[model samples]
Target chain A: MKRPFILIVAALTLLATAVPALAQDATPTPVPPICLNYVGQPDDIRTSYYMGEGLGYYASGEFSRAINSFTCVIFEIDANYAPAYMARALVLTQRSDYERALEDYTRAIQLNGTDLSGYNNRGIVYTLQREYDEALADFNQALELDSRSVVARNNRAVVYALQGEYELAIADLQQAIETTGIDAVLADLLDPEREEGTPPIRDYDLIEAQPYALLGIIYSAFALDNYQAYLRLTGSNGDFRIQSAAGALESRFTFDLRLDDGTWLLVADFAPEG
Target chain B: MRRTGLIGTRFASSLPLIILIFLIGVFTAAAQESPEPVATPDPSGVTVESCRELTERTAGALSIRTDAVAPFFIGLGDAAFADEDYTPAIEAYSCAILADPTYAPAFMNRGYAFFAQRADPLALADFNRAVELDPALALAYNYRGMLYTVQGNFGLALGDFTVALTLNPDDASAYNNRAVVHAAEGNYDLAMFDIDSALLIDPEYPAVYATRSAIYTALALIDAEAYRSRAGEAARYPNGSPIEVMGGLESAAETGSFATWLAFLTRR
Candidate 1:
């Protein structure tokens, strides 16, 4: 028994010594290399790093810094990068530098033909410049690309309004509102990955200005006079405020009148307390 | 045999330590195989020039010119206002003004932010500065008129509204506002005419209908049965108009500022 036990102890010691040696000799599994379309293409790390830096700066409201990072990728890393151009163009739009913004947008479009945002954003610049026909054409092209594009459709509505085609404008707004819901286009302007700290203001898209303006125009044109007609058309008493010229009594009342258009006009009176 | 037993006991004592060493080797190898965690960029005090430096340090960095740093902050303010974060919006607009003192929109928007925060004195100062900087800004006149109206200075309110109208006749909301002033002065006929004009401009205006109803109600109180009958007759569109419009008037306090007015005027 004693001899066998001695043999077992010797075996245990040998096994313990060999286990570590075996681990040392074992070859590690090789990591696969990141795939690239072509062998001579720029290394993915530098390109991705700058792109990430650009986006990070943008989120921090350092637009000029963001532009610099994007510029580095375009000039140094890859001249053909469409996203760099597009991002730069968006920042330029906020600056109201329409001409250069248009140029950058055009370049981005040239780089990537299928992207709808390039056309849509360029059309917004056109709208801001009051280049209505050009704006319409771009909007139409974007629509053809994707009929359900809320951004393009809302933009088209603004164009119609600018042209003084109220009916068509209202129709477009109704459709856009129904399909995408109110303030849906506002979503595109927001960055989802933005941190929860104080965020910077984005430029107002004129598309957001259409519906209310149209509503005001519509109510103005109808001129509903009868209280019932006013309620039938707009289901609320139009109460307006007025401070009494005689006493400190402020009163709220609905103002209505009969018009030649065979419509009843209703307005709210808001009277302030003295 | 005694020596053999001693060796066995020593081997058993060292077993746990040997196993611990083997586990440590496996863990170290795994740690080596994993990629390093990326460091997040420091966002503190990040500015336009700092960004330029980041690119300049890199190989092949181009010298690019950027413009309208002021407007960028104004946009930031506008965005904060949209999110209903009035404090940050005020700060952003202030930053915009600092970047470009001539930027009238910054003053105008800052005025709006002040109004939203109930800082009336500050709002008045900014609005005044906005009009001084750009007299052609119709929105400044519009909001200033609203402030005058709230303060019971109807004369000033009327003057400001008239100026806003003179600047932009297409402002349907201004027409609606002027009609309110007319009604307040007990000039019902003039009020009726202004309301008609507002309706002519924007038939879809939800508040005008309510304003129109108030006019008739006030008219009825004056002549009682006669105006009431007229109001009732107007309500009858032969067999009665189809469809009911439902909503409320946008408070002047809410739509008083140009920036807030634009937001409210465009709300669906």
Candidate 2:
């Protein structure tokens, strides 16, 4: 199963129309990939709500409903809206409809290739089909486009390790940890290169700020190697914590961890305790 | 306001649905300690009031500082899974569930978190609630089916797999997962047939090949009477587990990541 991450760029595309900016580069390129919110007056703003509703549905784990909602937005407003297709494609992927997911990813790319998510996401589908060569190609392009993208680097490292290229995998992991020390997996990945004076990776941040540590510590306690703590904390003690981003500027996550016999148990009922 | 489960039997049940909570019976007398006020949205819930009340107070007890508890727990769960911190993520999700019994997504999400953590029982409970809260949710059934198959519960596995399949015919996971149960039951023909079915829907799926390889093994192992060594060899080594030679399935499955999450649901 593909591990789900905090979907930012893709969420933006799905939530907002995400049109490209109309600025010209000194080198005579037409327009950059950076776009503004939906335009053309008050009527278009409704599209944004439809998109947000779709994202919320997605967040709530209702993929099919989210697809329908997004499809409705597409049909009701701009049929060419890429987010609608992208959102639907995500549902298709959950359904294991790779060809269709790939098709949508392709269209998403064609609609806006500069945003590295399209290539990176398509690459994931290719990897699922064991199309490593193709998966590698996509990861390569993704890394090329955004060299700082820790997710792409970490994923590429996984591909490398599966191919038995331990060294390459280690290098990629090293770089990923260096670039984003806040990555849970990177921290979980015990590397030999840490002794080589590697710089500590940066923390995960929100768009509003440089990055608030990504609160990644809540995620990396698995390999900590304890069993009793895991079993002790595995179940809900007849209660849960409820929380949200609430559009807050700070980055804090409600987190608890336990180690249960070769298993890492974590509980995160989001609330802004802090 | 209402316990999501049965309202009659539970002493300390904390569900958004009242009926299911009280059905558990033994936890009923201790309802007063549950932390939330139990509202008898329906007339039959007198016993659940004290129990549900305790659950509610505890559920809403997150301090302002603890306000990030649920989402933090959920994010931590996913992140922990990504980092292979399965144990910690499991704890995180469980806490999230406790914090809000009404949080259906927490149960579903935590169920997946537990699966990755290899904690089958916990995962089963989460998937159970996820499906219970949303009957048309195909992902929950598909997951529960896989868990059942792993335990060799073919009857249960088949039921869930069938339910999932009915929900989404094109879902390769539902097909591949059911195929394993078939293979385990010595029905190589039916098992291999499912693999073919999955591939038909998803030509590029590498997991199907891994699954098919297992079917090849089952065929070669059990169909010894029908095929001589040569025939057995043909059936089993039809390119030797396909993807192992191609070096694709594991890596491909890995790439799915968050990029490929689809849930099959009815129009509702």
The most accurate candidate by lDDT is 1
Q: lDDT per residue, candidate 2, B15-62, as tens digits?
A: 232223223211221221332322212111223343233223322221
Q: Can you tell me which runs of candidate 2 are displaced by over 4 Å?
A: A1-274, B1-73, B222-268
DockQ scores for all predicted structures: 0.01, 0.03
Score chain B of each candidate by TM-score: 0.56, 0.55
Worst 10 residues of 2 chain B by lDDT: B37-46
Q: TM-score of the candidate numbered 1?
A: 0.34
Model 1: how far residue B13 lies from native, Å: 99
Docking quality category of candidate 1 according to DockQ thresholds: incorrect
TM-score of model 2 (CA atoms):
0.34
> Fraction of the real A/B interface contacts present in each candidate?
0.00, 0.07
Kindly list the per-residue Cα lDDT of model 1 for residues A1-274, writing each as its tens digit: 9999999999999999988878762323223323221124344434554554454456456666666656766776677777667766766666676777788879877886676667777887787777889978888887777776666776676676557565776776677666645454344436586555533444444544445554554444333223334445544443332112111211111223111111111111111110
